[model samples]
Target: MKRYISIYSLLIVLMFGMVSCEDLFDQKPLDSTPAEDILTNEKDAEALLYGMYAYFGSEASYGRSLSTMLDIMTDASLASTGFSNQLGQMYAWKINPGTSEVGSLWGNHYGAIYNATFLINNLHTIEGDQDNLNRIKGEAYVGRALLHYNLVRLFAKAYDQATAATDLGIPYRLDYEDVTPSRSSVEEVYSNIVDDLEEALQLLPVNERYDEETFTLDFANGLMARVLLDMKDYDGVIDHTSRIINNPAFSLSSGQAFTDMWLKDSGLEIIWRVGYRITDANLVAPGYNFFNMNNVSSPLLPDYIPSDSWVNLFNSSDIRLSTYVATAATGYGWTSKLVIKYPTNPDFASQVLGMNMPKPMRLAEMYLMRAEAYAYTNNDEQAVADLDALLENRIENHQGVNISGDALKDLIADERKRELMFEGFYWFDLKRMGKGFTRVPQENTSTANDLSISADDYRWQWPIPTSEINGNTIIKQNDGY
Candidate 1:
């Protein structure tokens, strides 16, 4: 069950650090600590910020697990592959983490929530430049909101305009409470997500040196666009992405530079990302922040090959195909798999998984979001132009596309799927349009392999985590979990 804190106990435990307080208070403490107590120095404060990145990187969260889980679960007009079982579970609307990885997603996203709460609950106390304090707080706010968004997608139903007002969602928590907490409604969750973005926008500077990690205001805005898009708030989508589209830092990379740039940690497009740490134990896959696991950070081994479908998506002369891949012959064999983005550095010894993890938001996507908003708003010219701008830069034989009506919309959606494959946007796209998860387009059945559904089942919204139900009796669960 969801647990909460008591207002009083949450404070004493703040500066004092974690101690045995079970006997001291009957209920958990809530938000009693001020921000000053959080940091003794800048480094201490910075260290605390890393917790947000870690939370996002956890297997249950966006890290490798989520990216893989989301894609395999979808039937993309392609036949089923080895990852089809759990994928079936997702496509079918039957995912109970009480027994599977869904639990990990619940655990990790909340871990992010807990960390963000701790930091935001205490960020103000650090007696530094007010500007610095505000930046940190702003980031914490964005991080907290982003984590909540991740949780809601996995735990609550899709934001059905008809039922969202009444649908239950994960509990909304921003303070350091220790009391058992319950879930909120889906509408409440969306409201909270938007609220956080607004606050984060206000507090976050237009730009900053967030070390090799962290999200900026533009990044937060991009995320806001995504959340709003899911809620069917098309105007909100345009309003948010426009902030970055209005800015110059966000642009599509072209030619070899695009391929080369993806592997770098400090590129202009990344609004936020989990830095790759390359030690065997910490080693993780390399690829886009997209959902497809086919994109590895390392090159393919002697016989290791890509999914035949992923390869055939583009033609022999198409740009993305050759640019994004490498044979066993490339780069000292450090990366022999997909190696879609960052690869292991040749200089590092005792190699492990690359720590350069995924980012929830980036610049390349900003263009697509803007294009989509324009497409739906009936601005076909702007829509095609924006998408063309991206496509021209990505593929070699790419000619400008002229599309109209539903076919155009579908093409745009397909373009996004091809461009952002592993980044985790496909399923969300289908659901907002009330589509299905099946590739065969058989029928809209809920179970995996039924082949009836369009891969659009709202079941992707994860079942409520056990901790919430078992711990907080006051809470309620979503239906069809």
Candidate 2:
């Protein structure tokens, strides 16, 4: 069992660097040490910040495992036939407090939150140049908000304007605390997210140097666009994404440039990507969960593939079909179309398995968000303009056309699915829209029943982990769990 630390003790140990607390989720207790006695420098402070990123990249979080689990939760993909049975219940919508995925998700997200809290609470003490210190703090705040937003959406009910004040949201951990805290209201959680993002916007660099991998002005704006979109704030979505879309440094990539963007690290369209190195041992590269025979040789079988329903969503003329999907060309006939979105990082050695990076927010998503916002606000003219702008680069010799009303809305939603599938947005998108899914029937299994979930199904909200409820007395489990 891992040990826990009191809030006060952890903060002191963090700066002193006397404890082996590199991992954010480290449950081990640390010996009390004085910060003044330890060597506090910029490098030590930056190391802690990078550790937070490592936590997000862990298998339990954004790395291949979390992305794959979320994909299976939606209709876009499914757990491969031969993969672990632990996720079988998730794909089948049998989630409960006992579900390990629920527990893992809870743990990983909170772990990141705690890491951010430690940095934000104590980083000011580190002797660094004033500008660098403020930038680091801004990154911590934005990172905290990102983790909180993701946690709230999954653990709490969808953000309903009518019920947000009373709806149960995940604990908004912004400080170093060891006490079992109760869930906050959905409204409160979102408010905290916005406050942090706004602060990040002011402190972060408007134009970041190439060496900076931390969140910058563009990333903050893109994230707020996403959060506001979930909150049903269409006008706010446009406001933030416009800041990013109108920037000269970012734009939509077409043809080969778009294809290379996915395979390479940095690109014009990338707003911010969670990076990984080739030598990072046991790294849970999100791409590793997808098909890449060169790196992954296990069961010699792909763990997850695009469902027939998802495959049919793309058109032959659309560039995504070629860029995102590939033929398996081997045994394992669950689905013919394999995922290549996080294909291979060609810059790394072919033998490397964990080189694929996770792009959390990008320029393309901003355009799509802007289009959705326009569609929601009844600005169909501008809506269609944004849609066509994105599709022009996505499709070959795209003949631009205008669309409006319900037709325009449906097209925009479908376009989002095509543009953002397998990047961990499908399930969240469905939740925000209050839509459920029925998996496209598998051709290989005539006896198999297609999984169906209705819009009002209770399972739409995942159960809070049993361990948490047992430990935290003030915590109330979600209903019907």
Candidate 3:
């Protein structure tokens, strides 16, 4: 089992890669005065707060980096598409320790962190009404903590008790500094993230909604569940996820409502996600460099193709098959791209599927998290109850789908496999369970067999970006990478 060790070092390199060589803290003012000074009132604070969310919108956060990496590494079986190429060719991923992509992810996360730090530190100074101040600050804290958590997960491998104390985690950047910060151990990163969120969970009052369009208590709670789960604090995971699940305010949806989960300003299972209008200027041409969707098709790469077995795993009635794949004319004789997963075609950046935003936390994930935590805590009966709830919704004819014992756990994991496939949970799930590089090499297709993934690949633990080692004096490179 390959672990992405030394998450902090990898992050250091990746964070700096987001832009051209320059000061790490270079701030391109939206209108001139530094955000620190301008954000002195409700209106400015509101704008600045929303600006922090855009960090998630960056290709590194949800747009491409983490999301793409998550999908490619999991068993959703890549759609026979060109976009899948960068991921499928494990050899190709820059995260493959010491690659430019790894460097980019490092730089991107830190950049987001820098923006968050600025907002977080100055929230109080902004002259706003009690309601506005509390609301903006509450959301900022949670959002900030989450970015820290996200960085840790991608850079550090599982919290191995044996080595975590010494393992390098992503640098814990607390302020808006551009100096060389060395990596901390995995334990240090999680402890800091936990500390941040604990304070956040307290600071974020239950109210302060945004345009009926911002994060609320539900989002923070759901994120806390995720953070706990990543920490393997199964009991804590249960506490938060169960709250989100049992809350009458949130529930699963069907038909268009389900798809709307990804829509901008829409709320269903999603509690919080990134929001990128098709019109955002960040949209740029592909092939020309720096995160363009158009460049997506222009440069063809062969990635994960649905294996006969993996495809067969989905019930024929499962609508996701159509949602996740399309007939291809290129690699594997199928259109080599996941056209549907990025289900929306905005006039702005049509390439975005599931909207331009990434669902940072959602109710559906909470349900799954609770079920998994139940199983881990030996609450079999409760686990079954939670699992059935999810299955009933997705399965077409759920009347008699019998499952028991390991079979049941398999079903639940598979349910997650299908339900949460491309949303970015699969790879982490596989790695946590210690499944080695897996590949669905062949089967039932008429003339062509799709190669899913080859097992034993070490590309799992992203390596420390090369630049970080060269530029930062305090940073130490991961061992294996």
Top of the candidates by lDDT: 2
lDDT of 1 by residue, 92-206 (tens): 4466736456665665566556556667776665677788778877888888888888777766767888898887787777664546566778899999999988988999887
Model 3 lDDT tens row, 308-393:
44556677666566555554454244443233455443443435223445565666677788877877777777778887777666
- Report the C-alpha lDDT of model 2 over 220-261, residue by residue, as the tens digit: 888998989988899999999998888888889888888888
**True-vs-predicted CA distance for residue 407, candidate 3, Å:** 3.4
Model 2 residue 38 lDDT?
32
For each candidate in turn, the TM-score is 0.78, 0.88, 0.80
Candidate 3 error regions (>4 Å):
1-38, 78-98, 176-178, 207-213, 259-267, 281-304, 326-339, 345-356, 400-405, 442-458
Where is model 2 more than 4 Å wrong at Cα? Answer: 1-39, 79-86, 209-212, 292-300, 333-335, 347-349, 352-355, 445-449
Weakest lDDT window of 10 consecutive positions for candidate 3? 284-293
Worst 10 residues of 2 by lDDT: 1-10
What is residue 127's positional error in candidate 1, in angstroms?
A: 2.3
- Please identify which of the two predictions, 2 or 3, would achieve the higher TM-score against the true structure: 2
